[model samples]
Target: MSALPNNPPPNVSKDAVARSLAEAHRLTDPEITMIFRIEKPGQESNPAEPVKLLEVNPNTTASGIMPVKLMPHAPSGIFFPSVIVEVHPTELEDLKNGNLLLPNGWKVNYDRPL
Candidate 1:
């Protein structure tokens, strides 16, 4: 797996990366799922947490959007810093809209390949 510079945070250990990726993929299909490192929104200071597991729509060409599941609530407008492991070639433009949401205090850390 790949990540942005200082992405998982200096405190994030190698074991955490393995466990995080395993847990992230457990919730969705690995073939279509995207892994991300999201910054915590509030006063919380744990940067090692907040990895998001998102499912990519195979028919996203028309919609040009991907959904990330966090808790019970769903909103596409919460912008924050994040690192996306993989992105489809066709969806790069859509992913770059800069509107892709994460928690607060988060922004795109990197848009690298898986």
Candidate 2:
């Protein structure tokens, strides 16, 4: 398989991948920054699932669009096509409080902050 971000072949562990992603929050900001994966169900290999990340930070402006970013993704076999959502902390709370809605098909991976 080509060395793509979310490609399969089982080269890395999910825990390791989560750890790597968790590091991103550290690099940016831990308290107000949150990151996690939202997988789009699809075939495991062909066409490579898009890497979806839901990033909630106080620094970013809230929007309805799911924008793509050139972020890093660790290699894995059982990887998924991720749907990342970036939102402000208030937005996240609003989502939890039923004031905001997550883009359709995009759900929080672990249901927790990363």
Candidate 3:
């Protein structure tokens, strides 16, 4: 996980980062089925803060360990700070079904898809 710099107010909006992520990564085969922002446990996070997201993709390999990605959104003018976690369909279902929990105390507060 790339630590988002705690220096300045985030210049990249979640919306912008979302768009850039899809575009820059060109997620095709395993297209994103769902997306939602996550609230890291033990802290208060406003919309202006860096985001952590869970993205569900059916074709994404379910290696048991979900891959975490950090984006600076440099291609979209930088300043975007966020973590993107790729989850397989089954993993997402497990989470929704209460069979799994986000590691390291991360919580799902925003059910609204991004």
Most TM-score-accurate candidate: 3
What lDDT does the true structure give each of the candidates?
0.39, 0.56, 0.62
lDDT of 1 by residue, 1-114 (tens): 422224333554433543445454545554554444433455224443434433343433444334343321113221222333344534544555754443344544344312
Task: At residue 48, give the lDDT of candidate 2.
Answer: 47
Alpha-carbon runs more than 4 Å astray in model 2: 1-9, 29-31, 41-47, 71-84, 110-112
Clashing pairs in 3: none
Give candidate 1 misplaced runs (Cα > 4 Å).
Answer: 1-19, 22-28, 40-44, 47-49, 53-92, 99-103, 111-114
| TM-score-sorted candidate list, best first | 3, 2, 1
Error of 3 at 29 (Å): 6.0
Compared with the true structure, the alpha-carbon lDDT of candidate 2 equals: 0.56
lDDT of 2 by residue, 1-114 (tens): 333455444665444555555575567666546676665445323334455567777777876545554434434332533444677877777766777765545555656555
Point out the higher-scoring one by TM-score: 1 or 2.
2
Clashes of 3: 0
Candidate 3 per-residue C-alpha lDDT over 1-114 given as tens digits, one digit per residue, 9 for 90 to 100: 445644434664555656656554445534777776666655534443456677777888776546365645454553546666778889887777878787667776555566
Candidate 3 or 1, higher TM-score: 3
Those runs of model 3 whose alpha carbons end farther than 4 Å from true positions after fitting are: 6-30, 41-50, 74-80
